[model samples]
Target chain A: MSALFGRSRSVLSRLVGALVVVLGVVTLTFFLARVVSPDPTNLYVSPQADQATRDQVRAMMGLDKPVLEQYVTYLGQLVRGDLGTSFSTGQPVRDDLLSRLPATLELATYSLIIGTLVGVVVGIVGAVRRGGILDHTGRFVTVAGLALPQFFVGLMLLWIFFVVLGIAPGPVGRLPVGLVDPPQTTGFVVIDALLSGQWAVAGAALQQLALPLITLAFAIFAPIARTVRTAMLEALDADYVRTATAMGLPQRTIHYRYALKNVLLPVLTMLAGVIGFAFSGAVLVEGVFAWPGIGQYALDAIQQSDFAAIQGFVLYAAVLYVVVYLLLDLLYARVDPRVRL
Target chain B: MSVALAEGNLLDVVDYRGGFRGPDGEVTEVLAGVSFGLRRSTLTAVVGETGSGKSLTALSVLGVQPRGFVRTGGRMLFDGEDLFAGGPRSFERVRGNRISLVFQDARAALNPVFTVGHQLIDVCRAHRRLGRKEAEQVVLDMLERVRIPDPLRRMRQYPHEFSGGMAQRVMLAMALVSEPELLVLDEPTTGLDVTIQADIMDLLVELISSSGLTACLITHDLGVVAQTCQDVVVMRSGTVREIATCEELFTAPRDEYTRDLLAASRLVEAR
Candidate 1:
């Protein structure tokens, strides 16, 4: 009974911690949005407007109220899932942000999948070979990836593949402008294309997505490879590895079955970090490709000083980061016996 | 009398030389011209202080030496087959099927994620073609053969769940599952308590005899050699200092190193 109670207490503690973080982020973001240099009401009003027009615009935007009162109103609206109207688009900020989020999620997911597979395989091979030529070559590639910044890589890829080679699809958008209809299931163009059985549309979407994904993946690949290689090397030296070898198990079996299982936690932790980094890094890649993702939206918001849009974007990214990290922690606890719940 | 005199040769080592690379990539010799041979169906103990190349010699025979260490010269023959002639692939076929090694620490030796039964089954599956049920039965039988109380319960338990002695027994079971011609015990009883050490040694001795398997037991304890091994090889500073029958070495030693080791054992026994 006491053990059960102890478990319940830990669960409660985790919930409380998550709640405090969310509350703090929301409050800080609300205050920061209110304190920006330009008055938000002026962004919507004409310069030659009369005094009555100016006062009406200020009152309409709630800019006439004190900062604390405005903050309280924002918090109450946020609790109700109302992100308010955007001054620039005259659309609901929540709808605009939500609509853009899925595209970024799709891009991030694809980039993560490609990065993890490529990184883990190379890392394992490098570690297994240690000082051999394969190990040396893998290290060189990883170092190159680590040193090259994301935007530079993206620009170079565009120049080489799209301009010089002229083999890849042109950098217009995620899918061909009007040639294909979006799929209904997930609204992610790639998934929708695949689900609709339109191989050409799927192929075109993939081709369009390939350059940005590679750019994002290159930024993540180096760190993931380094982490996995270190973890694999440590696992290779473990006693169980020696024991497995002593048992006459094949080298591949020993490496994949015994060593890989133990090192998965470290690799997964690195993967979680990469996922978070990729979300932020996607901003540059998306802008370079002209992909309509939340990252590009965020960039536009920064340029226009769209305070509500910026706050919503930041909040969305924070929630994404927190959710992914939480899921990873749960996964790690399941895979490793040493981790307490 | 030496068991070497009683039975024909099972394992022979001659002129072994192995070492790791220094920081500057120069060869730093760990084993220098060490040589010994063991008779069939008997335990031969290699006694040495720490870093005396005892474990290195055993690893060389198994063809699983540490990285960066080169075996510059050696001929290790088991049942008249040269171990060094074959590459890693060929060595894999002979290792664990013809010869198996038990590491010094059993707790670290066994895979923590797997049950003892699973490890045993894996050994069987690696060397032979057996169905899952048959393999499991073999594991249970191995557990019983090692004198583990309640073999069923013990087989299901992981390495960490077992006591030190029990873990050692599981390791022995793993090593002997294929009934290899030779078993290398690298300080098998070093980390156990006094009482547990005695029990494990007795268990090993009984298993070796009943299975008619040869053993090369490596330890620094002369007393353990006197009790369990028929022949003894004394090593110091990466060189073999003496080799003799257990009784003869204990009673009439030649080298001062052997004599010093016996004297140390006597001091411990007296205490």
Candidate 2:
């Protein structure tokens, strides 16, 4: 019972910590947006517009009030789940994020899954065949993959597959421009299409996703494979691995079950950091692919000086990172029993 | 050792040579033609200094030597079968089936991720082809034999949860659960408290006598040798300097090095 209470208390503390981080991001972004610009109203209002129009816009945005008052008001609205309105689209920022978040998440999630699978397999193979040809080749490829810039890789892949070879789809949006979207249940085009039994639309969605997915997955998997290889090498030399081998366990069992289990926690912790990098990299990937995700939304907001939208995006990302790290900690406790005690 | 006398031995390591390979492929030999024999149902101690290659010799027999170690020329014969000639397959058949090894730093030797029971069950299942239930029973029985309190609950705990002495007991339980014909203990009491060391040594002696298991102990502790082992192989600088019955070595002291080792240990004991 005490253990149960302790666990719940820890979870509560983590949740509180996550909220604090989100709040800090919100406050910082708010002031930075306010301080960096000349005036938000000038970006919205034309020079041709009269002084009356500018004054009305400023009052409507609560800019006429004190900064502290505006902050308190913003905080109050955030508590009710409102992110104010975007100046460019004139839509609530929350609604805009809700529409686009699924695309970003779908792209990031698929990339992470693919990256982790390929990386782990390549890592284990390299470790097992250490100093052999395959090991050397794997190390070279992963190092190259990590060294190349993500945007350049995306452009190069596009040049080869789309522009020159004409094998892949063009750098269009998530689907063909004229294709009507499936009902926005979860907002993810592929998943919603699949749910609504729209196989062709889902297939088209995946086809459009191919290059960006490859670009992002390559960027993510390179670091993962390198880290896993190093960790596996160390784990393979651990005394426990020797003990397992001495027990006459099969070679495969010793390598995978004993040595691999020891490296999982470290790999998982690295993945949390990788996911954060992926989220930030999504902005460039989304721009390259012209995918209708929050990365594009964020880019447009920044160009248009939509302060509310920018603030919301930063806050959303902060919350996401905190949640991802929290989940990984729980997983660590599961994988390494020492963590539980 | 004469061939006629070695005929009754369970393991006859003849002129075994092994060493670590350099990065440029040169071999720096550490165990140069070290030979020994283990008679059935007798406890033999290989006493040596820190750099004397005793632990490497034990690891060589199991075919689990650390990476980069090259076997230049050797023959490790178990029950008259040349293990080196038969390759890894032969070592696989012998390890944890006919022979088991226990090392120092038991906590580091047990995988921290696995429950103690899980590790023991794997050892039991590997050699005997037992079902899950039978394997669990075997593990519990061995844990009980090792005098671990509350075998059922304790088995579910991880290695880090156990004290150092408890971990050693668990390691012993793991080795013994297979019912191997030979047990090689490599400084199994080092790093443990002196009192805990005594307890583990006593348990080892009891287990060896009760099961009639032929055993080899590798340690630098002469006191442990005098108390538990019946025969002694004194090693220095990658070679055996002396081999005698424990009584003969303690009473007559054939080699200068053996006599010096005894004197040093005795001085420590007296102090």
Candidate 3:
């Protein structure tokens, strides 16, 4: 019964923490938008426009209302899933944000899969061959990866592959601009294309996504690999590993089964951090390639001083971060028995 | 002790030399020309101080020397087969199936994340071809054989749930699961209380005599060696100073190191 109560308390704490984060993000976003220099209404109005025209623009954009009134109205609309209209494009903020979310999610998913696979394999090789040539090579690669910035790497890749080599086509959007009729079951073009048996479109989308995914993956790989290598080394020296070897279990079995299982806690913790890092990398890579992800959209909104679009984007990213971390915590608990909740 | 040796010789180690390389690449021997043998169904205790190469000798039998430390010269025969000559693959076949080791620290020896039953099942499945259900039944049977209370309930408990004695029992069960011909007890009861130590020693003796399993009990306790082992090998630094029957070694010490070790053991018992 005491254990049950402890579990309940943990669950309650998590829910309350999540609520606080959401509230804090919404409040800060509201204030930050209001405090920016040069009113947002001026972005949409001409410099020589009449005072009446400017007043009409302010009223339409809901900027003429009192601050508290605007917040209450925004909160009420948000509760009903209405994110408000964009000040410049006049499109529903929710629709615009949703449309670009899939692309970013796809990019993040691919980069995470690739980065984790490469990082863990390299880490294992490096640890097993400590002080050997493989260890030295892995260390060199990870260090090089850590040194290069994501934007710079992305530009270099574009220059090498698209400009100099001319093997792959130049970067445009997620899909070829000429392919208008994207299969629309899911907003993720790759998944939708595969589901609808449009292998060509899916193949093309994957090809276009590969360079950016590699760039993002490289940006996050060094840290994950370093963490995994450290964890693996620690596990290799653990008593259980020696016991396993003494049992005459195959070296590979001892490594993959026993050593890996014991060290997964550290790797999982590093993996959780890598998810956030990947998201940050996606933002820069997205802007570099003009991939039509939420990152690029947010950047455009900032430049245009579109308060509603900026607020919606920031809120969306915050919610995403919170959900991802919550899931990661639950995963951590499941993988390690020591973690109670 | 002579009668126990008359049964059959199970293990023989002759002139074994092993050492690690220092940072400056100088070879520092941990075990130098150590030699001993065990009868088929008797327990032989290799008594030594800490860093006396007792554990290293046991590891040499299994070909599990530390990395960067080469076994320079050794002839280890197990059941009439040269162990040192056999490579890792052949060593693997003999390790868990024909011989097993129970480490000193049972808590660290067991994987903390897995349940006791799971660890037992893993041992069973590794050396034997058995389905999961069959392996689980074997695990429960072994648990019961080890005298764990409520075998089914204890099987579900993780390593942390067991006391020092119980965890050592689980380790014993794991080592004997495959019915290995030889068992290496590396300071198995060193960390346990006196009462628990007695219980573990009795369990080990009973298991060895009943199953005819040869055991090399590495320990610092002369009393434990006297109680459990038939033959005794006293070591100091990296060399074996004396080897004799348990009675002969205790009744008449030949070397100063052996005498000092016996004196220390007596002090421990007086405490």
Candidate 4:
């Protein structure tokens, strides 16, 4: 029973830690966004307008207040569940981000799954073979995959898979232009479409999602595979693994069950960080693909100097990253008995 | 010392040659030639310094050498059957069932991610078809046999939580759980304290003697060989310099390397 309490305590502390991260990101972004070159109101009231017009626009946007007072007001608004308004869209930042969130989450989930599956198999083969051809291939891919940015990979996929062979759908939103969308019940059009029995819409959305998912998956694969391979190699050489081998356990059991289990803790740690970073940091890929996700929303907001939207984006990303780490910490503490005590 | 087999031998390893393959695909010989035998009820010690390939010889017996360390020329006969006849498949059935090894660095030899029970249970079931309850019972029984107090509670504890001596005992229990006829222990007391080392050697001797089991101990400590083994093989630089009964080798060393080792042992004991 006490152990149960301890686990809950750990979970509670993790949530508290996440809140602190939110506070830090909110404070930092609030201050930093203020200093970036373009004045947000210049996009609104004319830049060449008189000082009186500029002051009027600033007052209306709550920017004319002292910095601290604005921050206090921002916290108050956030507590009341308002994320302020996007200057460019004239829509509430919260609603805009929420609508685009499902798309980003779905894309990130598929990419993370793909990356993990590909990385683990490749890592195991590399570690088991050591100096064999698979090991060398994994090493080369890890180096090249990490160095090549996601947008470049995205464009390459677009050319090869779409332009060259016309195999994939074009750089469209979640669905092709003429296809009808399923009813938006859950904000995730794919799941919502499946729920409402619109298989065609779900299928079309998935087809459009393929290239971006591949790009983001490739982006996240390098770090995970590299970490797994290094950790697996070390584990394969561990004394316990040798002991297990001496026990005459089947080679498969020794490598996968024993060696792989030991390698998992470190790999999971790196994987959690990679997925968190990739989920919120796929902004460039989003641009190249024109996917209707928060990455695209964030990019447009940053270009137009939309102060409120940028702060919201930073808060969301920080929260997502923090939550990912917290879950991973709980998992590590559970799986690795060394840390549990 | 090689087992002086009057009637028959349980294991015979003859002119075993092993090496590591470098990136250039050349073999760097680690074990030039290692030959030894184990009879029904004898404790033998292979004493050597670091890089002398004592551990490699032991690993080769269990067919657990690293990928690069290949046996270029050798033969291992266990109970009249050539162990090398099946190319690892023959030992696959014998290892952990008929022969088992307790490695150096017991702490590193046990996985840190699991409780003692988790590992012991798996090992128990690895060779025998036992249910979870039956396997767990075997774990507790083996821990008790190793003289570990509070076997039930210790089962839940991780390797890092145990002392070096305690961890080595746990490993001993793991090796003995499967009831292998021949046990190979590789420097089991290397990192332990002097007092703990004596206690561990005593326990090992007591267990092996009570069961009349054959064991091969690989170590650099002459004191350990004297206290725990009946026979001793003095190895230097991957070659056996002297193989004699424990009493004979220490009193009348045949090799200069053995004489130096004896002198070093006496100096340490005197201090």
Interface root mean square deviation per prediction: 1.4, 0.8, 1.3, 1.2
- Runs of candidate 3 with Cα error greater than 4 angstroms are A1-9, A31-77, A129-136, A194-204, A220-222, A277-281, B1-8, B267-271
DockQ of each: 0.56, 0.80, 0.54, 0.72
For all predictions, the C-alpha RMSD in Å is: 3.3, 2.2, 3.6, 2.6
DockQ-based class of model 2: high
- Give a tens-digit lDDT track for model 2, residues B43-89: 99999999899999999989988888999997888988899998889
In candidate 3, position A42 carries an lDDT of: 70
Worst 10 residues of 3 chain A by lDDT: A274-283
Best by DockQ: 2
Residue A109 lDDT in candidate 4: 82
lDDT of 1 by residue, A1-341 (tens): 98679766776776677667777888888877766654776676787888899899889888899988988998899889988877667788899987787778788888888888889988999999999999999999999998987788989999999999998877787887777656668977878988889989888888998998899888778888988889999999988898888779888888998899887888888888788867753788888888888888888888888888888877777776777777786687567654655
Which has the higher TM-score value, candidate number 1 or candidate number 3?
1
* Candidate 2 chain B, poorest ten consecutive residues by summed lDDT: B1-10
Compose the digit string of candidate 3's lDDT tens values, residues A1-341. Answer: 99889988997898789878987999899988888743676777789999999999889867798989988998899899998888677899999887787788788888898888899999999998888999999999999888888789999999999899987667797887777546687677888988888888888898888888888888778888888888899888888888888876778878888889877888877787778655532667888888888888888888888878888888887777777788777887777776778
Q: How many clashes in each candidate?
A: 0, 0, 0, 2
- Best by the lDDT measure: 2
Compared with the true structure, all predictions reach lDDT values of 0.83, 0.89, 0.83, 0.85
Candidate 2: where is the Cα deviation over 4 Å?
A47-56, A194-199, A277-281, B1-5, B267-271
RMSD of 3: 3.6
> What value does DockQ give for candidate 1?
0.56
